[model samples]
Target: MRLGAIADDVTGACDLAGRVAEAGLPTTVLLPAPPAPGHPSPTTEHHEDVFAGGDDASACAVVALKVRTAPVGQAVDEATAAAQLLLDAGASLLYQKYCSTFDSTPAGNIGPIADALVALAGADGTVGTPATPGARRTQYEGILFADGVPLAESPMRDHPLTPMRDSSVVRLLAAQTAAPVSLVPWEAVQRGAAEVASAIGAGHTLVDALTEGDLDVIAAAILSAPRPVVAAGGAGVGTALARAAVAASGQRVDISRSQLPEVPVTGRLLLAGSASAATRAQTAAFAGERHTLDPLALATDDRALDRLRDALAARADHREPVLIGSAPEVARAQAELGAERAAALIEGALAELAAFAVHELGYSHLLVAGGETSGAVTARLGVQRLLVGQQVAPGVPWAVARSGEREIALLLKSGNFGGPGLFTDAWEVAP
Candidate 1:
């Protein structure tokens, strides 16, 4: 059994899963949700059942965990608890979700967790982390062993984040174990997938030709290959990507979304107007209806923002997905409106979405309109990134960036590209 685990925050989970599936590996992911301290441990029985159904249960499973920023104490505890559970479950390989925000400080949150996991898994264990110094705007040296050996390290160059830095420590640790190491960059993964597909079409070793960010392309390349394909990642994005991978491979593949069901809605409602216009529309759109709220609305000053928050207090309430248009402009306006006001609008929107997901909608799926909106929304939600843009086989967009945990999938078109289809592609909508 070649088991692989991806430990990361929510956004990273999706990105990694998409890449892994692209690599043509059967994979599973353990995603993070808001902590439920009093609740009993969720069941893994279903996962086991599913794995057993596979030809080689032991050989096929890969688990990825997305780590979130928690109180230093709680983060350590959660990591330890998760590691113990994986060990008990006989997980073959484990990867820790590392980030500058949580793991960069001297007394960082993930170090303790990684140490604990190493102790638990011994030689079989691997710790992985992403280098994200730019997004966090802070710096710290990698941890050292008692014998003066550095744990693990990987560079964060070309990652789609601001003032980029390296997330090499965890990768270094994983490499030390000589376990199958994966370096995940939001754009690299997708691009790599494309390249691998081209290579496979030309003839190459499935493993030898594999490189960082080649998962998606490799999976696509191996569509006709003899090996079984597995796609997995965090809940929402993972589910979508896995679906795409399965469709692309023309094969039956196993995948899972977040256990938390999302609030359902009807009508592809598009929220338009200025930031304020969209904000005003969001309140009315979801007032009493049961629908998913788009996290991007947080970037605007919508009048309904407050009302939506109030409505989401009850478990039965659900709001419609609020799409925020012209997000880059809105963000700029908000900045001019002063950080406090800007944050308030964004915060209000996020609070509404969170409440609705946890209570009313049960964590529903929502899509943002633009890359900027996707970035802003996910950032406010404490997610590092959200996979934006749709893939039409081999068509590559003009711009793409991967921030710390966030990824902005942008599809840009020139004014002269095409009169009508340009707008459609920009919005990732079918023409």
Candidate 2:
């Protein structure tokens, strides 16, 4: 079947599948979780048992498994068993999950897995991560015993997992591989659909292997005619990718009999500090409204209250979106705003909903601009699992989880992450 498997953290798996699909291979992604909410208890029980079985049919049939818990030795043991089972089932290809904390170096993780896979397959095998260059060197030294190949992806260039992606293990794999290791450039796909088309036009075969978020971008790419589309990754990205592929290819996108997720987004955001001028400008530009969140007014002076109120009022008047900037600063500001003031803002926004409009007010989307503020707002709200972006950096590290009735989207940024036009790149197409 010329099949491939991707095993990594949840986000890495989804990102990798998106790249692999661009590279042109039929793929499947298997996550540890079941998709349906309140699904049959037996389904969850069966999945866990499948791993405990450590057999080939179970392993070969399985494409990807996300290990959320740490001390990864146990996860590795389970993976080894599954690999053995898959080999017994006549499977030749396999991939393992790699994390920075466990291996300390990419090769530390990749080498042993490759050696094991080679021993089992009696042939070469692939191991990879979206880690980084220095770590890749360390991985190369560790992989002395086996023929290792590294698969690299671009979307994760600045990702927290960079340590794993750029490790020596990946570089060595890329150098040794017969063909150029698949390069899934984040910039190419960030434009959503057109990049997929461009990749196929550039001679790559498209595989529909996304399993998170919406498939709107992927669907647009498939419609452009990338051949042999295969769906895999997080259940959300996978299902959406499969549906899109089916609609495009006029055939069903075969799915593994694994449980998947129903909703596309999960996680939360934490904002801290006052909004930066650049952030307000960017938000205003993106939302097609005038800048309202005044950082100067909110931070340097004691008028944060008035500034926040004014910002909210402006949003109400123009129906423009409001994005809180910073997390740490917001936390500090919270002391001044007090529980009563903070709750009033949130409660006021919520009140604007149809039923509460007379007595309450609310926002369509609460975008906390800064990571620190995000944390403060979430804590004040007494909610956990809110979407959070990594400490303000290059690409916003978005973590989405369910929060009551709200689907929070946090866009984290720092003064140094970029200047006024940083996010403009997100909207640009790769030339």
- Indicate which candidate wins on TM-score: 1
Instruction: Please count the clashing residue pairs in each candidate, in the order shown.
Output: 44, 76
The digit string of per-residue lDDT tens for model 1 on 35-149 reads 4567433223324332344342322232323233334556555565555555556654444544322224333444445545555555322212222211211212333221122
lDDT for 250 (candidate 1): 75
lDDT of 2 at 198: 55
What 10-residue stretch in candidate 2 is worst by lDDT?
138-147
**Model 2 residue 118 distance off true place after TM-score fit, in angstroms:** 3.5
TM-score of each: 0.42, 0.33
Looking at model 1, residue 290 earns an lDDT score of 40
Residue lDDT tens for model 2, 67-99: 333224544544555555444445433444333
Q: How well does model 2 score by local distance difference test? A: 0.34
